[model samples]
Target chain A: MTSSNNTDTRLMTGNEACAEAALVAGMRFFAGYPITPSSEIAEVLARKLPSSGGVFIQMEDEIGSIAAIIGASLAGVKAMTATSGPGFSLMQENIGYAAMTEVPVVIVNVQRGGPSTGLPTLPSQSDVMQARWGTHGDHPVIAVVPSTVYETFVWTIKAFNFSEQYRVPVIVLLDEIIAHINEKITIPAHDELAIIDRTLSSQPPESYLPYKNTPSGVPLFAGFGTGYRYHVTGLCHDETGFPSSNARIVEELYLRLNRKIDQHRNDIIEYQTLDLDDAEICIVAYGSSARSAQRAVRIARQDGIKVGLFKPFVLWPFPGEELAELTRKAKTIIVPEMNLGQIAHEVSCATRKDVVSVNRVDGTLITPQEIVKRIYDVQV
Target chain B: MSFRYEIRLSGSGGQGLILAGKILAEAAAIYDNKNATQSQSYGPEARGGSSRSEVIISDEEIDYPKAVNIDFLLCFTQEACDKYCVDIKEKGILLVDSDYVTKVPEGKFTVHKVPITTIAEKQAGKSLVANIVALGIITGLTGIVSKKAVESAVLSRVPKGTEDLNTKAFNLGIDLARELK
Candidate 1:
């Protein structure tokens, strides 16, 4: 891939992978700060966007970064930002604002082990729940986790799609393992890729209700400078985006926001289930750990034990319905993550079955043999 | 009987391990008409860190994106050798760059330490082709890949003028491996 793809695959890191995804997706603006495990995204975009007729700014902090992206998005530009764990926490206020304003922006969080700078170089999937509930209020976030470098290319494109289609924030949850892993992935030309453009409202300024929902429950947002003078605010707003404490309006708007995610469960949920048709035990993992589970299943099968794997590609929508369906066939479910049983809680809640969690807190990957031993230890 | 082998190439950041894996995986999938996938993980700083690439080449479709353990382990540095030596499956070959790496592990499977660096310096006039030389040794030891397929990948991917130099380095590795007993 070293230049044969028309653009040189010139030794790209995971950070570069995200930035390139944004560039090809027609993003015109980028605002991000330098943070460990994710700074490369900023560095690459700083150099690459200008030649493509785009703007890349190194903001003073993560707050400024999120603010800049929202500003750009509101002005009819495709905007993006990248951050790590703590920086993501800092950007939540503006993220909420982007939600309330119905702005389409892409936020990439390349996670490292952290309550705060815990392990910068190591890999961890501890932020699965935080991605869903981090930003303030009841607003939705489309969080996609990519396990391998090849996937970074695919999910980055999905990030742009979810952001545009929903008119809200879309998060790409890439961990340190994949963010730094350098690999060869053949990216097809734009013609071969199916890219979704932002949904724009055609209604005139006077008739526009800023919060009006389509049948799909997502509002087709018109950018600010496009003559749509609809009001927007941080407070709970009515149809025209004016603050309203009215019971009926608030109730309807709140249900529609949540239902937007629920109705598109099939489209939003991405996962791979292997050998569950005849397995006594199953492993539920995401991101880098999913790679380990894949190998463990193959090895376990070779050893005469029927083992299978379930890997969640789209993490935020939770893929709860699929897990519920899978529960009836399997006897036990093993959830392995970089942190101490983060995603396991979700598996237990969704499956309602006794779920076993193989936890690792030190920031290294959970090995395949470890998962296999868990299956044998909890044998039927 | 088909084999499911994940070949991992590990070394410093500039060793072209990722490129080697790409060429090998493409050779398997495109040229050999087998299923193949390549994945990599690196450090923050591009150069002078441990860089590893995983390649899954199979006669059937590949189900997993990650490589658990490797069948062929190529290490160009002591750090990489120390790291990946024990992780390989039993009876798998461990190919180390002898000119750069001197220490060899006493293990069950044959550990071939070829002077890949010296060979590349003599042939290609630089250490850039050391990776190609080691790749040649890899193909010679494991008969899963073909000489024509790898040469095609190298000739196609390398610079226009440097093709002959790299080809010379690759053939030197093929010859050096046969010279190894």
Candidate 2:
């Protein structure tokens, strides 16, 4: 599965890797605004996409950027957009629109410090919740966070796959650190990658229901100008693709949208674990924090501290079951994140245990020494 | 060999030190089969602002990407040397560009002064290749990465038609470092 025709290793930033992976994943349309820490993704695609016959358009603003991608996705092309904190905030309404319409699109949010324009050049994992709930409504969300440049490439491909698979907009959450840092990665051949396209309705135009319910709860999507004249809107709609004000129809529409992802949680959830077999203390982290936690776990094990690490790459549809099973045997759980205990609260509720949160919102990374010191304190 | 070797290249933003750091890291990781990570910090200004790039090459996977205990520091400007000298590990190797950086701050690290800008201008006919010259000197002085590997990485990154000039500058840097020893 890992085999490739062209295995040349190149040094690239995480943002560059994301752009390259999107192209490899059959993304032919890119619409984005230039934002610090995330603008490189757009810059690279701007130069590279044209040579590959892909269209790269820098929209007027972030809102237009996301809206353009949604429109392109509806036209039967894999599309994406990239932005930072402030830009991400502006794209939320369009993101929610994509969610309600079940348009398959990928959004790359290279996160920075924020409630509003806090720090543009610095890194922070503060947008984890925003990624899950930034958009309005109760629609299901799928967001993948990558810690390394290599994983950034791999997960960007997965982001497109998941979006097309579940008919939802997928978010790739990147902090400023990983988005800007350069590292070596071996890019596999095009033939070696598992590229997925959206499933099209096989039924004729007369019987083609754009929002027809299925066993998987994921409706078959038909592109515009493809002989399927179906209405698409952000409003709640029935199975026939028309807006329905009926309470029962609206309830079923929302429930099916949520169930489409919930029922397929096993396929969407991805995580990494280390030394949890006989450990008494566990450090749960994600994004760039997971890198430091890996070092902390290694150092703690060398000192016989019985500490381990649980890193969730898929932040949304939160891996509650996996965390629950890992935390059941551990005595103490420590969560370290860039924001002030954003994901820590989720860990506590999932495990039904006391979780110690080591948070840093000062735009500096939490070091391994800080996590190690906290582990020693918990031991006492 | 040590488990990890951290290198820092500091200078003005236009000195191309960030590209130098990337080449060094790629040489170690792609050619030498070591794990490496490269990161940079610069001010808002594109040029003339203080800039520094760090590369950490390790035998194992890099946990924290940033360099904490720098084993080698190459400073092309006085301000960069003064601002980042304290972060170098005690008894580490510090290389400076003698043409631009006149004053060498007193530190526990061993200092080697070389006219990198002059060498690039006089010998390579272009000062833009000074960063590549510094890469050659660092690889020659410390032997952290193979000369063949650095050359391959350099040729891969340098612009299409400037390979001959960059290679000449790199070789001259290696010769100068050898003479200093």
For each candidate, report its DockQ versus the true two-chain complex: 0.21, 0.47
> Candidate 2 at residue A77, lDDT?
95
lDDT of 2 by residue, A111-199 (tens): 98898988777789999999999988998889999999999999999999999999999999999889988887888767878989989
Worst 10 contiguous positions by lDDT, candidate 2 chain A? A1-10
Return the interface RMSD of model 1: 5.7
Instruction: Return the number of clashes found in candidate 2.
Output: 0
For model 1 chain A, give the 10-residue run with minimal summed lDDT: A2-11
lDDT of each residue in A1-380, candidate 1, tens digit only: 34433543433446777888888788989998888788888888888899989999988999999999998987888999999988988988988888767788999988888888677666788777788888778987788988876678778888888888877788899887678655455565777766887778788888987788689988877788887787778777877889988999788877887787778878888888888878878889888788778877887888788778888889888888797887577888999888888789988989888799998888677888788889888875
Model 1 Cα lDDT, one tens digit per residue, B1-181: 2678888898888889888887777666655656676776667566888888888787764545556667889998988888788878889888898876788777776788877788788776888888888878887778678888788878767778998888988898788778874
Number of the top DockQ candidate: 2
Question: What's each prediction's clash count?
Answer: 3, 0
RMSD of each: 4.1, 2.5
